[model samples]
Target: MPKVPKWVADVLENVFSGFNRKVIVAEINHLHPFIKTIKFRGDLSGVNFKPGQAISIRVNETNFRNYTPSFWDSENGVFEVIFHLHGNGPGSSYIDGLELDDLVNIVLPRGLDLYKKEYEYHFFFGDETTIGLFKSLKQVIEENGQNYIGILELNEDTMHYELKTRYGLDIVSSSINKAQNAISFLQNLPDRVWELWQNGSFYLMGNGRSIQNFRKALKEKGVNSRNIRTQPYWVEGKIGL
Candidate 1:
């Protein structure tokens, strides 16, 4: 759990900051008939943040989850996160019923120190759940004037994202239910994943099983475990009553 923010502490006993800081609204971008980029917006004005960090959201007392930043300018106080709807989760529920100007409560961004300088060619991979982190990193990498590689695994319907000129977007094909099929896609990696990592590092966000498989595969190919940084976007059996 994150330390409660200062504002909402008065009303919140288990959380920091008692007030609604983000005032979130959903930014729906329909890439195709099924692939939708639901960008969740929070108040980011004048806030300087490291790329690839995530904001923990408390949808209500009963629900709270973390979200990576979507492709948007963090410094300008505007942030976005994109996720494919799987139904029944609080995050999904709030996003489904979101209006243009509803205020949502959120915590400060937290995660691994993504702005790490050791990496050469930046690479990010995960399902639609990680779109926000991908988007946030894309902006930061491009803004810093560096070239990066990013592969997004999403349902064919939600394959829509128009990045700034400097960012490269590659969408992988998978079934509508991404949890299972996306894992298969990465397991095969179509082509060149092993060859591509010879000189740089990769940041991965995936399911527990997927990450386990990915680690095993990387080690078999002589890729150091330290060379791969991973965090699962959703683990099997985690979301529940």
Candidate 2:
């Protein structure tokens, strides 16, 4: 299929304007030196959002970006999205420039369904961009009486502390190594956790290269390809995925 051009995207945005929800920025929290969380309030009724799904936000006339909600409150019409301000791209600038009461347009959440009930245990891997998805999964896993373990590789040292203190996510853990060191981290998975790989559902996201490396390492460890799901949000030297 031919790639759609920017002009077509703009036209489609206008044609489907009715599907867009108007949201207000309710709050902002700088979780780390490189990460920020934005709270949004809008009419979210009638939308069935899955744990790992993401919503596309219209950042400007010709730019749209996908963001996974950290949590959703259908009754209250509120949710949160975490952003990694690693570059000066349009998405980063738009998120950074947001203030309380600022209005934005976002489409409904849709993406891969990672919260599988068939599996007894799940193992999640990602970087800063995976934080929101991790948060979404943790809640559903606990509610469903299932087990899950998250190993996130973040470049910022403060991310680990913030995820624990600010977010109170005890089930998810983190490493200080940059995303490039994901292979080494995956290779050194503790012997105690190796037993969980059997019959485990693996979810990998974030940096594309790192996700590929982790997926390969998991396969080398005898994990079935059917048990692994990956979504590469960004790639090295690439604008987006």
Candidate 2 lDDT tens digits, 141-228: 8788988766677664544545655444332333433343555655676887778755699888897777777787788888999999
User: lDDT tens string, model 1, 57-79?
Assistant: 66655556677666555554566
Per-candidate Cα RMSD to the true structure, in Å, reads 5.3, 3.4
By summed lDDT, which 10 consecutive residues of candidate 1 come out lowest?
A: 158-167
Model 1 scores what on Cα lDDT? 0.60
Q: Rate the local accuracy (lDDT) of all candidates.
A: 0.60, 0.77
lDDT of 2 at 232: 85
TM-score, each model?
0.72, 0.87
